[model samples]
Target chain A: MESTYLFLTTVTIQSSMAVLFATLGEIVTEKSGILNLGVEGMMLMGAMSSFAASLYFKNPWLGVTCGLITGAFFALIHAFFTIGLKANQVICGLSLTIFGMGLSSFLGRFLIGKTGTRFLIWHVPILNKIPLVGPILFNQTPLVYLSYIFVPLIWVLLYKTNIGLSLRAVGENPTAADVTGISVVRYRYLATIFGGMMAGLGGSYLSLFYTPGWKENMTAGQGWIAIAMVIFSTWNPFRAVIGSLMFGGINALQYYFQASGITIIPNYILMMLPYIFTLVVLFLINQTEGAKRKLGAPASLGVAFEREL
Target chain B: MIEIKVKQRIAYPKITKFFTPFFALFFALLFGAGLFKWVGVDPLKAYKIMLSGAFGNFYNFSEVIVRGIPLILSGLSVGLAAKMMLWNIGCEGQIVMGGVGATAIALFASPYLPNYLVIPAMIFSGFIAGALWIFIPAIFKAKWNVSEIISTLMLNYIAIIWMEHLYFGPWRDPEGRGFPGSAIFPDAAWFPRYLGTRIHLGIFIVFIVTILIYILLNFTKLGYEIKVIGESELAARYANIKVTRNIFIVLMISGGIAGLAGVGEVAGVYHRLQQGLSSGYGYAGIIVAWLGRLNPWGILSVGIIFAGFMVGGDALQLNLQLPSSLSLVLEGALLFLVLAGEILPKYKISISWKKLSKS
Candidate 1:
């Protein structure tokens, strides 16, 4: 029983961290007034390329870099079309997902089953002594620890800086921001690319640490769940941590139930839990006034920006 | 000084509208050729084999239409709802539910009903099932201002999982050595096949639906209302167009059509609601709907092209010793190029480079 408890906690943290990274990335992008719906594809790019790079270079660091570059590369397609060509943001985002998914699956064929260097657990000396939390929190892959640092760092970057203020201004009112000499387009591009980078890093954790191997369509709807997580977390980086943990807990619990054979309900019903939970949470959030105001989307969230002289 | 500018063309060249899609197709083929070359295959030869594989023999050509029938119906589902600016991404869920509904009839009522009665009953049941699935998102959008994109997509997971439950659990065929699928659909419930070929009457059903949708969008008042709503919801409301009702109406139609695709697959293609019943047709239909510019005639043609992508993927796998995922690559690249090319007629782009003079 004690071992089972420890195992569940570890699974929850590891699973949630993958979601936390992508959710945090999307929060940054959406906060900058660009709603990129290509997170899933970008995650796939990260998961595949990172595995490929880790294997090819025989270095995990190179794998991390590959994931970041590939993710940003896919996000670049959405940025170029939606920002550069002034295309419909939804269509552009959807196409990126398709293109990214197709390309990743095509390229990832050989990488499947071939093993790469995976992130190993590093137990901190003093922290390892903690009773219940040590095994789950202290002993984790390096990326997991970095995620803890990165989450709050991103939160501070988003809420406590001049750049953050400027980013918010652009999202709230791009034309007004333009009047004040803020380059809305440039900030959007940066925010989007950074978001993509974070999403890539998140996916790297999945391939490099979470599963430790490449597979076709491995990211497997986690990116989309991350999008919903942004909304659920009220588009705040800090709240995203809680949201990701909640979802990760559910995912972990489902596995526990399946493996333990404790529940009378079928495993498929357990599989349906996260999705049903999303719909219910979305409904409940919609019903509340404070939540509605807090979770409201940016005014120009999906509108194509056109600079008319 | 060198400058680049894009201008909206004033003239609506009627002939150009037809040719524009062809231009997009050409661009996609060119991009595909580059991809093929990168893969160490001759682009021209690959495309030749693709074309011939899709249309070379009677067998190949018929297979193309067989795949296209469901695409056309699902495309119409997306196109019609998109006309009202109601994004029904839940067509995947709706399609699955439609299959579930059709299969219920086939499994339960096939023993008693005559073939004619069973077929119509299954199709109608499928449409109703699809409609029921979409109604949730529509209501949420119309009343609570929820984003249909998220809700619909999430619903797809639930629908698929629920179907899997039936396949693996209660509905599992006992006679098939514990296979995770239902018994073969009775002969009475099966769609009539043609000329010793795999093609079913679903081809005719799709053709008729396409014609009807075309006339509805071009000549009907409801279609005008949908167009107005799509362009600007405020304008549609100002004209007293019952925006909320229309949102539900269009979604219902969209869901129903997608559901019809489900029916076609279960009855016409598989004859049993089992694993691999869809093969992602619902999602693929979205690409077709957009590529077709949400028009019936355009959908019919685009559906055929996408069908070629699938048929050709099979050929690539069998002949070229390559992965069948080439279809996905081709589809994704084709969509990107086509959407980019669409910008041409709307805005004429001009670029020039010259030496800069010091200020």
Candidate 2:
């Protein structure tokens, strides 16, 4: 019984790490004033690319790299349209998503019926031997540990550094940032691309480790969930960790409950818990004035910036 | 060449406005051709197959119009909502609920009512369901300033799950032999088909709705209010337009129109509630709305064009051994190009010597 509980807990943590990584990555992108609806497309592409590369190269790390690169490639297209051509951000983002979905599905049709190379969890010798906290905290796949590390790292990059300051400045008031000699467009382009890469890596983790296989539309609407996580976290990476984990936990609980035959609650309602939770969070956050002030987004987040004549 | 620099400063004639979209379309086609070529297919042959497939036979051509009906309604929904500066992304959810409401009436209520009464009731129910689905987010935005984009999008998942639950559980047809869907509606509940084709009276309804929306938007006071609000909320408020009420009204209308699209699909085409009923018509409507520049008449033209692509895509899959997703690729490319086209008209490009040298 204890072993079963430990195994279930491990699965939940792993799944949560995957969601947390993706959501945290999206939070950074939204903070930079670029709303990337293409995360779903990016994740799909990443999943396929990583799975394909891992099968070919026989190395999961290489697969992760391929996934990140694939995601960055799509983001480049988004950046060109929104940053270079000065298109509507939301429309451009959605187009990227549609394009990504179509392209990935087309690719996957050919790739269907093929099994992906599986990955196993590796642990450090000393860290693996440590007591209760160490197993929970330290003993995870390298990708999972990387996700935990990214939270504080992203926080520092978004709040403490000069580049971070400029990113926020550009998001809030691009004209002001441009006047101060910062390249607002350039920063936004880079930030969006970086965020896209992170989202891609997060997706690759699904195929490479989480489920260790490929399925059509497998990421499902998790990409949208990641987008909602940004709002739930109030645009903070640290809080996004908690929000995404809770969502991941709810998702995992549905599966466990279904398997356990505790059938009082309908599975569909349980499946919908994350989205319901997102709506509730939006309500709560919007209601609180203090939360609104602290978590309020940049003034010019979605507005397209053009230099004044 | 005659030196044309005779004291007059000539302004470029906004040629970019017309040329940019052409260029973007050209490049998109080029990219698509490259993709096809990489797969060892001749680009021209593929295009020929796609075009001929969509319009090859009389039967195929009529199918395009049948598909265009829903596209027009959903396009009108997005176009109308955009005029009020509301991004109604939850059209997918609204469409689903619309189908649910319309189907419910067709299954349960149509038997008890007269034919004339039943048809209108289904449509009215669909509109109400759609409006109610979107009402929550609209109200949240109006009262608490929550982001409608997020709310509407999140609601889409809820709507889809709800549909799946109904189809897979309680509403599952007793005679379906384990298939996940409701039973077909009675013939009285179905829309009237056109002469010797699957095309239904819904096409006529779309045409009428298009005309009505056009008149409403261009000639009515409510239309003027929407235009004013879209241009500037502060200015509209100062002009006593009652921005909140206008927002709510526009969103409800938008959701209702979107719902009508779902009703048309369920009652006219499928005659039964199936999982594949939507096939992304709602999202495609967004592209149609933008391509039409939010003009109702424009939506009609763009809607037909979009439906042609869908039919052509189906053809490409069957005949050319190409992926059907090619249509989506084309649509995405068209959206990118059209938006870029809109932007080019507002700005003039100049080649400055200093900037050129710096580069």
Candidate 3:
């Protein structure tokens, strides 16, 4: 039973890393009042680029960096269109996703079925000796530990910093932020780029550590789940842990069921649960009138901001 | 310092609006050539291959039409919904369920129904099933003001999983050596096809549906409400439009149309609900709808062009050994370019080296 618990908990953390990174990134982006719906696309490009880079360079760290760069680069196109040209955020984001998926598939085609430098499990010295929690947390890849650092860092950056204040101000009311001598464009761009980098890092985690190696459409709806997680967390990085863990738990359960060859719950139904669960969460979040206000989206989430002359 | 000033256009030239999509295509092809060059393929040669592959012969052109049938239906589905400012990205799922729905009729009900009635029943059931598939998302959007984008997208994965379950589990054909698909759909369920070509009755069906939607969106009171609601939901409420009911109705119709695309795939093309039923036609519909500017007639033209792209992309794979995903790259690039170009007619942009002081 303890072994099973360790297995589930460790696998849960492993699965949660990607979503956690992406959700945290999106939280920052949305906080700055830009709704980028291209997380899936950005993540795909990140994963593809990371995998390809790792294979070429023979270093996993380089792959991780490339993934983040690719994600930010994709987000840059979105920024230029939505932020610079003032294009429709939703449509542009969709295009970004399509672009990412296509580009990744095309570029990574050669990398299919090939292995690359992957992050292996590294046990920390004394930390690995801790009873239950250590084995579950300490005995994992570098990316899992990196995720632990980011969750708190993002929380502090969001809720306890001047930069976070300006981001929130811009999202809540761009006009107000502009009057206070804040460059809404600059803050929004930075936040969006930062968000993209995080999503890229998440993608790297998938390719360099979690599943390891490049595969077409490897992110496989986790990017979308991260979007749902943003809402699930109510834009709080700290709360994002809960949302990611919930998703990771679902993934771990699916893995467990398949591994045990359990017929009690069909494999397909288990696969469907994550999506259905996301829908249900969205429904519940919006169902209550009070909850809608309390856990509302950023006031100007999808709206473009143009300063008045 | 340089400053770029953008001012909203009071009136734009009609020619710019008419030529924007073409220009977007030109830019996308230009970028596509750059991608080809990057991948060690000759740009001009690649273009020549793609063009010839798509339209070199009557047979190829017919195949393009066969492909365009689904594109048009899904495109129309997306375009109609977008008219009311709704994004029906779940058209993919709707298409899958539509196949399942039609398959149910073809596999089970065909024996009881007369030969003439089977195809019609499959079409009807497919449409209804697609609508039902989207029912949850529509309700969430209408009642709770939830983002239909996420809800609809989530349902897409669910629908695909369910379809996979059906084919891989209970619906698996036993007689055909344990094949992972249902028994062949009876001849009664087979859609009427043109001689010596894969083209089916879907052409006429799509035409009728397009015209019906065009008339409904233009000449009708509900059309006016949809327009007003799209412009401003507050204004729609002030004008006594039943906003919630309209949302539900429009989404159901949109989903139903997308489902018909699935029917075409199963009844008109595959003749069985199996793998390759959805080849990203639903997602491709988004590009068509946007490229067509959400106009039914425009969607028809764009649908054909996109189908040509798909065929050409396959040709690239066959001839150059390039990934067919290159076509998707072109489609995505086209969408991005079109979106960037949209700023042109809407706003007049001017750049100056010196920053303006005060006014």
Candidate 4:
């Protein structure tokens, strides 16, 4: 029973890491005046690229790096349309999603029926033995710990730093930012690309570490879930961590319960638990005063910024 | 010798709008050829194969038109919503609910209704289903000022899951040998064929709807109000256009049209609800609507062009040993290029010739 509990907790922690990385990445992107509807596609590309690389290189880190680059490449396309040319952010994002879906599907067809080397955590002598917390915290892959570190890093970067201030300024009013000697376009492009890289890394975590395998549409709708988590968290990176964990926990619990064969709830309904939770969270957030303050969202989010119209 | 002089100030043309798409298409094809080369396929041969497959046979041509019908309908849905500055991304969900509504009527109400009555009932059911699906987001936006983008998108997943549930469980056809799909509709419910081909009356319906929507957008009071609202909500409010009411009405209309596309898919083509009922037509409609600049007539033309891409992609898949995704890549590239191309006409680029020569 102790071994089983440890195994379950380990799975939960790893899955939660995936959610954490994706949600936090999306939070940054949305806060930069760019709503990336293509998160799903970017995630899929990352998953496939990372998986393919890991198979070829026999190293998970290489795979993860490749995933990040793949994500940035696609984000470049998004930036070109949305920031460079001032196209509709939503449409460009959607096009990126469709394009990514097609590209990933095509690539995945070739990668199908192939397997990659699985990633495993090296036990840290004393670190792996400190009871419940040890296995959950220390005896995990480097990416898992990095995801935990990212929450605070993102918080500081978004709220406490000079670069963050300028990023926020661009998001709030690009014209004003430009007037103030800030390159609004440059900041937006950077923020969007950074967001894409994080999303890619999150996808790599799924393929390279979490499930440690390749499958078509493996990211499924996790990209969209990350998007929802951004809203549910009200755009706070810290809160985003909690929201993602809750989602990850709910998702993990459903699978656990189904595996245990409790025979209480139907599996299909359990599958829908996360989405239902998202809707409830959306309602609660909308009802809250914090939502009115708009503390977390970029003011110019989703609006096209034209320099001289 | 002919000489072309570079002007110091870029002279932007307002009437070159027509040429922009052509330029964009040319560049898109050029990019597509480069991609083909990357994949180790001969671009010229692949292009020939794709074109012939899309337009070669009579049956294939009919299929393109048949596919274009739903695309046109969905494109009109998006175009109409855009005119009001309402982004209806839930057209996919609306289309699904529309299919469900039409299916519910065909399966349950067709037994007691006359053949003439069935078609109208199905169409109405579809419109109602689509409208109902979008009503929640519309209400949220109108009342609470919530972002419809997020709400409508979230609702899309719900509709998709709901659709999967119906097909896989309660609505599963008993005669389908365990396939997760609904029963095929009765012959009385099937749409009439056009010109002895597999193409149905749905194409004609799309054409009629396009013309009607063009009239509604160009000549009607509601269209004027929508235009005002799109231009400036403050101005529309000052003019007493009932912004909230119009928002609700326009969203419902957009949803209804999208639903009609679903109805066309089920009643006109499939005759039975299946798992993959829509091949992203609703999502693709967003691109079509934008590409057409939200004009109803333009929606029709772009819709057909998009359908051709879909058909050509399938051809590439079958004949050229290429993945169907190549078409998607080409389509996306086309959208990006077209958007960029359109921008050039609005804003001219001026280059410093002396600096260029120095470089």
The model with the greatest TM-score is 3
Task: Rank candidates, TM-score, best first.
Answer: 3, 1, 2, 4
In candidate 2, residue A143 scores what lDDT? 87
Query: Ranking by lDDT, best first?
Result: 3, 1, 4, 2
Which runs of model 1 end up more than 4 angstroms from their true locations? Answer: A289-296, B1-18, B344-359
lDDT of 3 by residue, B1-359 (tens): 88889788989998998788789889999999999999999999999899889999999899899999999999999898898889999999999999999999999999999998999999999999999989998998998888889988898899988988998888887785767677789999999999789999899989999899889989999888888998999999998899999999999999999999999999999888887788789899999998998989999998998999999888999999999999999999999989877787888889989956786
Can you tell me the DockQ of model 3? Answer: 0.82
* Model 2: per-residue Cα lDDT over B78-149, one tens digit each: 889888778888888898999999999999998799988888999999999999999988888777877787
What DockQ was computed for model 1?
Answer: 0.61
- Native-contact recovery for every candidate? 0.47, 0.63, 0.81, 0.37
Q: DockQ values for all predictions?
A: 0.61, 0.64, 0.82, 0.50
Error of 3 at B346 (Å): 4.2
**Native contacts present in candidate 3, fraction:** 0.81
> What's the CA error at residue A78 for candidate 3, in Å?
0.8
lDDT of 1 by residue, A1-309 (tens): 898998788888888987899998998898888888889889988999998999989898899999999989888888887777777777777777777788888888889899988878898888868888876888888898888898888878878999988888888788888889899899999989988998899889999988889888787678888888888888787778888888888888998988888887778888988888777766665666345655656767877666655
Q: Top DockQ: which candidate number?
A: 3
Question: What do the candidate models score in CA lDDT, each in turn?
Answer: 0.84, 0.82, 0.90, 0.82
Spell out the clash pairs found in candidate 3.
none
Under CAPRI classification, how is model 2 graded? Answer: medium
Q: In candidate 3 chain A, where is summed lDDT lowest over 10 consecutive residues?
A: A288-297
